[model samples]
Target: MRPPIDSGTVLITGACSRIGRELARQLARRARTLVLVAHQKEPLEELRDELLASNPTLGVAVEKCDLSHPDEVDALLDSLHRHLIQVDVLVNNAEQGEFGLYEQQRWPHIHQMLRANVSAPMLLTHRLLRRMVERGRGGILNIGSGGGRLYIPGMAVYAGTRHFLEGFTESLRLELVGTGVVVTRVEPGPVAVDAHAPPSWMSISAVRCAREALEGFERASPLVYPGLAYRWMMRLVSLMPRPLMRATGMMAAKKLRQGTALLEERGQRVLLAGGPEALSR
Candidate 1:
């Protein structure tokens, strides 16, 4: 059974951009109170204002903390608890990805990505899961990627982190079988959030993906594909042999390199900097 929609507050991490921002807006329509969390203050403030503009009486709060830092993540949660705030919906939307080979990636960036993508979520969920279990009514939505299910070269660490989340979510669902708390893992393929793919791919818009995620949450679905393409892709990938999948990934990588080289030759800035695209390889 699904939980009541308008009964409580929701806390969304990485609530400042793209899918996270849209999810916040949609949830705000049903949730009585919202806590928007992000690493940057400016975007969070902007989102808070935007929400307030839409719902004048909406109780929107902004929290700024670097989740990559364990201390900061804990401190942020502590501050919320101090204010007597209870998170009925915990959207672990924050993620950091890599764009290069594992060995080529700097130690600091890899460490930070691991911390934010894996450690922070694990720690935060550990703290909140117990409470949600006790309450017997809560929603946990984790934003994952298709990289986890496929063998992508440049994203070794990134895919590893997402795969861990996927495994964790499944194990957690089993553990909470009889509990009312719902756990959802959203694996979106080529979201239009500055992905590193060539310009030909039609990636799902972030808003569309966010809407699907919220809809899935309402239905208490354990896993959701943000778009039809991704759903079909998952099935296809699952049917492919392991070695075949690796070979396909290699072919895709070679094509991407070819395109990148062509663009660079034409004096086009081959790198798409900033936003989620920077995370893409």
Candidate 2:
């Protein structure tokens, strides 16, 4: 069984993209109100319309702002505050990943990735944690990647940021132990959202992933892995020696790169539903 969110407002970052979009859609029907955050203006608006079209009674507000820019996030939050918005659930779902050696990765891109994946969520939590603490009830789900626990060669920075969240969420959960405020870290495997280049792994649909994630959210678990396959894979990987895990990551990355090259040569970019840049970048 899970707790109901009849009167709580939910805020979802990157709400126009694959997983985020699906999460917003799933929660809109049950959640009292929703604040959707995304970087692009037009797409965010489009998502807002789509949601409203389906659920006219749903209270949905779209904020077009780049989470990579702390200033913009602050502005958006400030606007929400001025309007007396009360958030009861937060989904830190915005993140960008770059695959390559740390030395070869561009610095600017790394900084943006860090800001989006780590700093932005941390900042948002810092600002909103007080409210949830004061109200003595709410939930915060930090969406992370399996790379947080499993080492992958081409994703050092990505892995580090996700691992940091693993530690951060655990510590926060302890602090909010008796406060009725729950914190959970949701680690989903290679979602079909951005699994264009792959070794033919079965990627779970974004809607399915969101559904499973929210099921865990309602349970208020401290940590959740969405799919059974991901759970089994993690268990098996955890049993493997560290050296073996590293070798497997290298092999996987190599295979992905080979596929990417093949697709690029054909002048056809494999991407998520919305657009190519949305997935490839």
Over 4 Å off, model 1: 194-201, 252-276, 279-281
Model 2 lDDT at residue 162 = 88
lDDT of 1 by residue, 170-227 (tens): 8987888888888888887777754232333447777778888878878888888877
By summed lDDT, the worst window of 10 consecutive residues in model 1 runs over: 193-202
Cα-based RMSD of the predictions, in order?
Answer: 4.0, 4.7
Cα displacement (Å) at residue 21, model 1:
0.3
lDDT per prediction?
0.80, 0.79
TM-score of each: 0.88, 0.85
Query: Candidate 2, residues 92-190: lDDT per residue as tens digits?
Result: 998887665566567888898889888999999999889888888888889987778887655777888888899999899899888888788888876
Q: What are the clashing pairs of model 1?
A: 194-277
Tell me how candidate 2 scores on lDDT.
Answer: 0.79
